[model samples]
Target: MRCNVAPHTFRSSPYFHLTRPLTRRSLKSIEDGLINAQHLDDQIPTELAPGNAAVLIPLANVMDVPGILLEVRGKMMRNHSGEVSFPGGRVDATDSSYVEAALRETREELGIGAQDIEILGQIGPPEVNLRGNMVVYPFVGFVHAGSSHSDHTNTVALDEPLPSCDLDAIRRNASQTEVDAVFHLPLSALTSPARLRASMFRGNRPYWAIGVQDLVSDIPASFKGRMKQIEHDDVDDSEIGPGKYGNLEVWGLTGWYLYLLMKKLKLYY
Candidate 1:
């Protein structure tokens, strides 16, 4: 269920000169380097929403490019439509754990099966989205190449970089009302503060809204020219710091969680 954004209309923002060129990182290095991973069983505040949800902070390599996976919610959804968010949904009573719930949602929304995901750990505490009145528990999962699907046993493959991780192979959910688009935002660009901007206003109130433009360039050239990303994104005249950032703004609870992930991973000094 992907909508075509016109080719000539995506806003052209100034690009930041990255100190180093973006390259695929070694998965083993990342796993060994990860710290401050929280326990997945941490409690959730059920009162924050009718039913809390578990979201996957999916990290994978797509077409040889390593990055985090995100989605554009379809406008007709019950909540959080037309927004950028990790793949997830409300936790069902049958769910064994938030980890299970997150993986389940990843399968439903992105068509990736549980065998392809390697659960790293939780990100932090559950985030409360006042706009959606939703409480979401975020978990980090490293997606592996389809050829190396976990036996759900020995995980020796995760000890090294498996170049086969590809999202293009999965069949996308065909329902337009559920997910409009699924794209991976590169981690290298995501780590640099120079490559990101935080808008300070939503309406008249103050907030730290992050706008990430890195993925704009990642979009295939043929389709990027016509998409007015910020238009559907609902960006106002709020300041986005000193330099230009891409129009793919991450606002509300998603923005808050993303900022925390950056700090937790220590992706940048």
Candidate 2:
């Protein structure tokens, strides 16, 4: 769908300057380099069922800056229960493709329509297993800042504004069973290495890193080697531990998924 913003508005944004010249070859090179550079995917357990799907990592401009939209599932929901996650679900019979599934789910979950979103290419698909049965497909989409949509039309109402909810609610809602929450990390954080750190979680539990393509440059060489060692290590004796950094606790599939996404996206430091 086309955005309503004027062409002149694009001149002031960094995206226009930074992404305008990205040719197919360069984009492919970046994607291919990520695929070959790490063994993050080796960390996911093979027992999970594979399923086709998609998720929109919604980006909205807030205060002239880009931020992601995330949702805290209702406490009563089954499966992940109240955990944080993007607005997405498994591909269904009516869906045409992964992208279509993501868009449809987003509309259902957030009450945002397809016309409001700007498809800025895919961030590719990352695998996530839910309830030991389904492998999730994730796609990233961007929406301009100052964009607004009405969720009131839907059966459920998302009363909180996306940005305000991120700062006030996401962390507070996290707990053992109802611990699902989602929040957007700034793009600057994705490109910078200064904020990245190697974290050992939950009694020094070792997790298989699956998604590290976006944050590879920020990782230290020593840590990279250690990760490689962990990947090849046997899983028999490993224990789950608390996260070494950040408020996030790394345990179960959730931690593993986070590690994979960060590793694949290279969103460290």
Per-residue alpha-carbon lDDT of candidate 1 for residues 198-237, written as tens digits (9 for 90 to 100)? 4323333223344554553343232233245353334433
Backbone-clash count (model 1): 8
* Full-model lDDT, candidate 1: 0.55
Whole-model lDDT for model 2 versus the true structure? 0.41
Clashes of each: 8, 40
* Top candidate (TM-score): 1
Superposed model 2: Cα runs more than 4 Å off: 1-52, 123-125, 128-132, 145-184, 188-269
Q: Candidate 2 at residue 100, lDDT?
A: 76
lDDT of 2 by residue, 166-187 (tens): 3333334333233234444443
Task: Name the lDDT value of residue 147 in candidate 2.
Answer: 40
Residue pairs with backbone atoms closer than 3 Å in model 1 (clashes): 6-226, 6-227, 7-225, 7-226, 8-225, 8-226, 9-225, 213-246
What's each prediction's TM-score? 0.66, 0.46
